[model samples]
Every structure is written in C-alpha cells, then in structure tokens.
Target: MASPLSALLLLALLALPAARDAAQDRVDDGGGYEDEEGEAVEEGEGVLPSPGQRQGSCPSSCTCSPDGAVECAGAGLDSFPASLPADTQLLSLQNNQIEVVPIAALKRVPLLRTLNLQNNLITSAGLPADGFMVLKELQYLYLANNKLTQTPGSLPASLVSADLAANFLTAISPGTFGGKPDLRSVYLHNNRLTNAGIPRDAFLGSDAVETLILSSNSLTRAPLGLPPALQRLHLRNNKLHSLSGGAFDQLRDLRELYLQHNQLNDRSVDAKTFTHSRRLEYLDLSSNNLTLVPRGLPARLVILHLERNAIAALDSQGLGRLRSLEYLLVHSNRVRAHAVGAAAFRNLRRLHTLHLYSNELNRVPRSLPAHIKVLMLLHNTIHEIRAQDFAATPELAELNLSFNRLSTKRLHPRAFTRLSKLASLDLTGNQLTHVPVGLPASLEVLRIQQNHVAVLGNGALSGLPALRELMLSDNALASKTIAPNIWAQLPSLTTLDLSSNALTVVPSSLPASLEYLYLQNNRINSIPEGAFSTTPNIKGIFLRYNRLPPHVKDMFMGLEELQVLDLTGNFDGTPEPGADDGEGGDGEGGDGDEEEGMGNPQKELPQRRRAVERGTSVPRPQKT
Candidate 1:
C-alpha cells in the first residue's frame, strides 16, 4: 500500500482530466440569449433571458423572443406598444393601465396566437362591435381581473381557450361563442351571472366546449344548453337552491360535477335530474341544506360526497340503486338509526369506505357492506359495543371509536373477536376500568388512554402477539394490580406507556424488544439493580414526579443504550415501611424503626445522599 500522502496525490491526479473536460464543455456568450425571433437579448451574467429580460431594439422594459414573442408585463404603458415586432406571435401586456384595446393599432401583429391583457382597466364599452376579429390567428385570450362589463364578441374563429373570470360581466348573451368550432374551454366564474341573465341559447354557438367553470357567481339554477361534449362542470359557491328536472338532460358526456357550497335543500332537486348523465363518475353536493339524497343519480357514479348536509334519513330506495358506488361520505349530518333501515345499504355491494361520523346514531349502523375496510365513528354518543357490532364487516382494517362514552361493562367480552384483520383500534376518551380482552392476535396498535381503567388483567394482552404499541396511560393502575409478567407475552412490544398511574417500582418481565418506556407521574420509590437487564435496547425512560430511591444510578446501570432519562420532581429519598427489613414494603417512605436505630451520635452525620437530578448524563455501558 502507498503512503497516505502518496495515495491522496494519486486520487487528485485521476480526477483532473474529467474536471477539465466538464469545465471546457460550457460556452458563454457575454450573458446574451437568443429570443423567439432569433435575436439576442442581454441579461445579467449566468442568467437565462426569459420573458422578464429586455432585448436590444425592443420596446423599453420589454422582453422579446427570437421567434417573435414579446412580454411588456408591468411596463405601466397606457396603451399597446407602438414599435412591437411586426411578426410577433405572442404578446403579454398584463398589469398595465391601458383602458382600451386598439385593434387598429395591433393590426401590425396579425399573426398573434396568444394575447394576455389581464389585470387592466379595459371596459366593454370602449371596444368596437368587431374588436378582436382583426386578429384571425388568436387562439388563447385572457381578460381576467379586468373591469369589462360585458362578454366580448366577434372573437377570432380559431380561438380555443378564453378566460373572462373575475370580471363585471352580468350576463352571457346569445352568440357569445358562436361559430367557434375550436373553442374547447371557457371560464366564466367569479362573475355576476344569474339564472335570468344567461340566455337559454348562451352556448348554442359553440359545439366543442368541453370544460366550463361558472363558480362564485349569482346563479340560482343550473345553466342550460350545455354542449353535448361537455365533460367537467363546476358550479360551486353559488345560490343554486333548486335545479330543474331537465337541467342536465342535454349533457350526454358529462363525467365530473361539483355543486358544493350552494343553498340547495331537499326540495330543490327534481326527481328526474341527473338521470340522463349516464357517464357521470364523481359528484360533490356538500355544504347544502338538503334533507335527503337526491333521486335519479346515474348508476355508474363511483364517489358521492354529501358531507355537512342536514339529511336525516337513508332508505333503501334512495341508496340501494347505486350499484357501482365505492365511497359514501355523509358525515356531519343528522342521520339516525331508525331513519336508515336495516336494508338501507344492503344493495351497495361494492362500497368500501363509509364515513358516518358526527351524526346522531346511537349505535354502529347496521347492514354495512362486507367489503368495508375503514369505518369512522368518532365524536358520537355511543355508549356500548356488542360482539355483533362488527360481525358483519369481517374485512375491517381500521376502526375509530374515540371521543365517545364507552364503558368497560357495556363492551361484550367477545366484542372484537370477529375483527381478525383489524390492525388499529382507538378507544381513547372513554370510561373503562380494564383493558378489554378478546382482541385479535394480529393487532399492531392499541390506544385506550383517558379512561378509568384501574388495572390490566393477566390475560388482557395474551392474544395480541404482534402488538407493537401499548398505551394505558391516564389510568389508576399500580404495581400491585399489574401482573408481574404483564409485558412478558408481548415479544414484539416496542413502545409502552404507563404514565400517570400509581406504580411503586419498575414492572418486571419487560420484553427485549422494548425501546421507549414512559412511567412518569407515578409513586415508584425504588429501582433495584438489574431491573432493566432484559431491555438493553431501551432508548427513552420517563420517571418524573416519582419518589425514587437514593441510588438512581444503580437503577439505570442495565440501560446500556439509554438516550433520554427523565428523573425530575423527586425531592428526597426515604425507604418505605419495612423496605430495609428484607420484607415487602410500599416503598413510599422509610419506617420509623430503621431510622431510629441509626441513633443521633454519628460523627460526620453520614454525608447526605444526593439524588440523581435532572440533566445527569450516564455513560453508555460497554457491550459484551
């Protein structure tokens, strides 16, 4: 082997050729870049000339492309530039003070394909009847965030996309998009449109319109005469309280529909509405005042969102018809058990996810489809869970019953025996006295905190072989009530929480796989040596607010891999009654007999034993 200095020099020499080649491959043109028109534009060093860079011989404060594209955005020009390149294909004069668009002045760049005059003071009264018709090649036009009072007309026949959103346009007159065979998308959202303002034939002139966005308007009813090729429609954030039965009968190709944040009520929807939209797949009717699901929805729908509605009932005739539906969300409603009969959802065979949270149901809904994998029932008044509550849904993988009034006695002994595939179960914030048994062996996470569970019986965790996290905090358990081998059967246990209990010492039989142990706010008074010998992999141990013995360092000697050990709030160390007599002791304080036997005649008062306080670092023990 070469010496260290010689090896370092050899590596540097091997990288010299490759580094030089990489540096030589780069070229610099004095920070000048070519534009759309094949002309050079000067920018700063190491910066690419984009739409913000000014070019030579172009208008002041404007960027010109080599292929004849110009951007004069935020230039403060009162009107169109007088000296633009005659062959410019794209012109962006947005964020200016131009009050009018002079087509005669723009006749120079007749080949322009895109024009962006957004965020200007342009008004409809300032333009001629055939204003934009002069640019026959215009394809994409944007006039959003302007002061236009009316929709522009006589647009170029080749136009494909138009955006007039956030304008003052109150109505869409006939022939607004007429004869434009290539116009496929139109945005009229954030306007003052209403039912009477939109003519019946507003979109009759265009047969190729595929996407229409009319949200945040004043419309109270659905728009009519939508093109047959329309696929997506957004009418959210409006006052559409009712929809005519024939409102959507003409849309044969509609697929996605959004009508959320409207004032629609139960009587606002017609019976025959949406019956003709055979290809519809997604529907959102949230934030409405409806009392029930609207009738006549297409059978091919996949996701139905009715969250935040006031619907009170779910009958078989209303939901059973949706054979292909997969997701049904009716949370934040007033639904009751009697309102949803037993067979209300029996026909929804393919349903996989059902959310009925924040409802008025007294118990878990019955007749849930067998394919349900996730069930959410948080924040309800449910007080009990029976063995058959989850018998119908054996494939359940996640069940959330938190924030309820559940009791231990009300929970049947065999309540969770059928959930063989369940992985996560949350019973937090309830009134229980013990860890419910009969849990599946495949459970991985069990949370039962914020309860009155006083003790964990011996067989409470016997069946949970694959358990990894066990949270039993905020209970009234003590070392006497807990079995000595409570944690012995949990071979895969990693995180154990026993804080805020009445423990007197560190429980024994801890598994080797344990990593995090929480025992804070307990009555533990002693930690003997070899207490944690089986748990060498432990990393964090919280013992705050405990009455620990004087020799705390000996208590942590077995924790070789410890990282964070909290021993705060402990004031003094005094042996509990009979603790020093080689007999059972509560370990809370020293007995009077042992302390008096020491007598008060000792010479230096036997140096006071200082406890292991906060921030005391322990050296990691050497591994064997």
Candidate 2:
C-alpha cells in the first residue's frame, strides 16, 4: 500500500520516456510515415489513437494540458505514466497508487483547468509551488487523502471548488487561498489546526464563496463577519467555547448551520446570534452545554438540534413558542418529568421528527403531536406507559423506546391504539418481560433488543402485518422465540435482530424476506431444528458470542442464501420461553389471544381460559 492510498494496486508505465524512445526507434527503422524532414511521424497531442487505433509506436505517456482534457483512471496502472498532453482542460488521476505527483510533469500541460489528484500518494514535502503554477487554466482542484499540508501550494484565481479534507495541514493563511476569487465551496476538515487563529483572509477575496467546512479544528470562537452570501457552514468538533453574539450576523443568506460537538455554554448563544438569517432552516447545536436559550429564535427554523444539552426540562411554555420547528432533537439532555406535556408538541404543527432519547423520565409524556412521524425515546428511565401516553401520536411512523426501564406491568393495551400509521418501533434495552401487542398495523421496523421478555405467548405481532424489521435480541427467551412458522404470522418482517439472549434454539419458519438476522451471545448446545425454514432469502446472520452446539447440518442448514452468519459467544446449553406466537390466534380470539396483543388485556379474559391454560402457562391478570 502507498502512503496516501491503503487501496487499489495497479501499475502504470512510469518509464514513458524509455518506452517512447524504443517505439520511435522501431518506427524509424521501419520508415513509418516519414515526413519531409525525414523524421519518422509519430502520433502527437490529441492525435493519439485509442487502444484500438494505430498499432505501431504508440506513446506510453498521456498528459492533459491547460486546454486539453485527459482522464486515465482505473486503467490498471499503479503509477502515472509520462508524456505531456498540451492544452488540456481537465486531468483525473483518481484511485491510483502514484506515489508522487509529477508537479513539474503537469507544468508541461499549461492549459489544464481541473486537476483531480484524489486517492493518491502526493505528499506535501514533495509539493513544489512551481508544479501547480503552470496550470493557469485550473479551476477545480480535488486533492483529497494525499499526505498534503496546504493544498495546491496555492489557489488559482479561477478555481471554484477545493476539497482538501482528511489531511495534516496545521496552518492556512489568508495567503494560502489567496487567488481564488470565484470560489464557492472549500473543504478543509480533519486536519491538525491546533490552537490557531484563522486568518482574516481565510475567507477573503471570495465574492462567490458560499460554503465552508472547517471541522475538527481548535477554535474557541465562531469565525465572525462571514460574507453575506455564505449559506452553509460546518464547524463540528472544534474548541468553539465562545460564540460572539454577532458571530453569524453578517451572513444574511445563511441557511444550514452545523456547530455540534463544541464546548459552548448557554450564555455563549443569544437570540440575536441569528437575527438577520431569517431564511435559515437547519440549525445544529448538539452536544453542547447550553442550558438556557434566548427567546425568539428564527421562527421558521425547519430543524433545531439541541441534543446532548443540559436544558433540564421542557414545559409547555418554552417549547410552545417554536411554532414552525419541524425536527426537534434534544436527546441526551437532562430533561426530566413534569416538564414535558402531551400538548407541549401540539403547537409545533410542522414538527415531524422528535428525538428525546436518554432522559430521566419514569413515564411517557402526554399530548405529543399526533402529526409527528418519527419519535425516538430510547435510553431513558421510563418505567410506565399509560393508555393516553401516545394517544395523540396518530401519524407516527418511527418510534424508538428502547433502553428504558419498562416491564410487563407497564404496557398499556391501548398505548399504541391510535398510532395507525406507525412504521418503525424500537423497544430495545429495557426490562420488558414480554412482547406487548396491538402494535401499529403499519409498523415496518421494530427494534426490541436487550429486554427481560420471557416468552412469546402467541400473536405477539399480529397487528403489525406491514412490519419489515423486528429486533429482539439480548432477552430471556430461548428456542421459544424462534417459531418455524414465524413468517406465517408476520409475513412482512424483513430484518430480525435476536442477539444476546437465552436462545437454545432458532426459529425455523422465519420470514423468507428477512435480510438481516442477529442471534449472537446466548446458551445453545445445538442449533434449532427449525432454524431458517425455507428462508433462503436471508442475506446475513449473527451467531457470535453464543454457546452454539456443533451440529453442522442444523448450524449451516438453509444458509447458502445467507451472506452473513455469526456464531460468536456460545458458552452453554439453556432453554427459556419468551417466544410466544399466540397459539390462541389473532386479536379476534378473546383472552388467549390478548396474551400476545397486550399484557394487561390477557388478564381481562374470563377466568375459565386462565384456568384451562394455568397448568401450561402463567396467566397474569389483564388490566384492560
């Protein structure tokens, strides 16, 4: 592997001079197409034939000049063969192992406009300013991932877009990008810009500069006084602890602002921080220590990212003001109980995505907007979900309630009764003793990994016929979870995640549409006899970290169609009963079926059925 490229092994005829000389000798000996000067005629410049053209004495080197265009990528060459193509407009050296860019080599092609040196080993120490200055026609320069310091050695005046990410440049003076006046986009992220003050000229001279990415730098303040045309700016993962109130005031046309992963406290931001940027739509201030926000933010903000903050809580008053907010991501915050109301989201009519994961709440909030489509509630302290908790969320399509403190006693029968359009449901990482039912009929993805679920009584997901992905790994269930007729119940399930559980057996009749099946880390001496019954469409399977028995036939059976299968962490043999597939049938059946729909509904069934199944199953009181 080369220094800049850990990929793509190919060889190019780097010794173009030798090859060309030898071919010329051969052509001269044959007296091929001799001109009046008695010199053997050879194809020159753009007159060179393709691989299928004139056979004798073809030039080994191909170059593009400032006016001509040349692209020799993926031609099975490891290095840049030589020879200058004059007046080239564009030259691409993509996906090659050319250890060193012939900077002087490019000088021969003075008319070059666009030079793409991406995925190469052109280093900074070898970068000569003279190698780049000759190409006076250069406009776009893509020099990504090539151990370079300051790219291009210099920016040409006509250049428009410059991509220099994933490099090791520690210093960029206003002089570094001095020439480009028509520049529109500049990418300079993932570099060693430590404790450095960005030059005032960092964004100077660019009358058309619109987007700039200076991420992963060491800056304590927002770069103030940006051009008015600046629209998109990315400054994530920087030491921006202080943001001036007018840091972003000059950019009247700014739209998307990404300032995540900074150390800015609440006082660092102000309402007037975005006073004139009325057209702004997306604002990402995630992973910051902002506890207080100034009133009257941009009213028409389409996305607001306040995640991983110390906002403490969100009562009806504070959140009610953002009338036009669409996506509110405040996850990983200290927001706790009594602060969030069901109606708190009712005012945000345009709100569609709400991410409140990792909070300190024991119960679900009420009056959440029914119009919200994506709701993420994972990694919280929620232990109970009342009937009206999610009553108004009718349009919810994706819901993630994983990593909580939920249990069988907390699942309300009508909890999801109103979410008819719900699609993706995540209940992973919790204390659930069973798979609660009456899931939205339109759910497509369900993630319930890492729970205390003990059994799949039956019809656990009968309502979610449209479900495509079901993740239920790391639980107390055993072979009982894997029903051979699993597909018969949920025919639409496409992805199943069942890793880190007490699975001594695998479900044989899983849906054939399953593309991803995760079943790692559990106690199982032998593979289930019904593992993957006719489900050849499975593309991947994870069995790592489990005590899987060495039964070759059962282990790899029906796995030819599987593209991935892991058998990691299988230590012992055990059996648990959480795979309840409503042997009692769909929700139409009274108490027996309710056992799989909602935990409490089963208790409402007549005592006669409980008496009959009491010997076979534990019949808890249903609280319908």
- The list of candidate 2 runs beyond 4 A from truth reads 1-67, 70-83, 92-107, 117-134, 143-155, 164-181, 191-204, 294-296, 315-321, 341-344, 445-447, 458-464, 467-624
After superposition, candidate 1 runs with Cα above 4 Å error:
1-131, 457-459, 465-624
lDDT for 621 (candidate 1): 36
Query: Across residues 1-624, which tens digit of lDDT does each residue of candidate 2 receive?
Result: 352111111112222223323433333243221111101111212232332222222124443222244656554445455564444455667556555655546655565566776556656654555456555667667765566665544656777777666566777766556646788877766666754546656666675788887777667787754556788887877788876667877787888988888898867776567678788888888888887544556877889999878888675455676788888988888777677765667679989988888877767776777688988888888988888887877788888887788877878877887888877777877777877867767778777777777677566767677878777766777776544454568877777777677777665667767778776666655665556665767766666566554342234433445444444233333211111232343212444433332343322222212232233332333333
In model 1, state the lDDT of residue 497: 95
Among all windows of ten consecutive residues in candidate 1, which has the lowest summed lDDT?
A: 601-610
Predicted candidate 1 versus true structure: per-residue lDDT over 138-249, tens digit per residue: 8778776677778876787898878777677798767567678898988777778888878777777688888888877888889887777899888988889888758888
CA error at residue 443 for candidate 1, angstroms: 2.9
Superposition error at 18 for model 1 (Å) = 42
Candidate 1 backbone overlaps, count: 13
Which window of 10 residues has the lowest lDDT sum in candidate 2?
33-42
Any idea how many clashes model 2 has? 68
Score residue 169 of candidate 1 by CA lDDT. 77
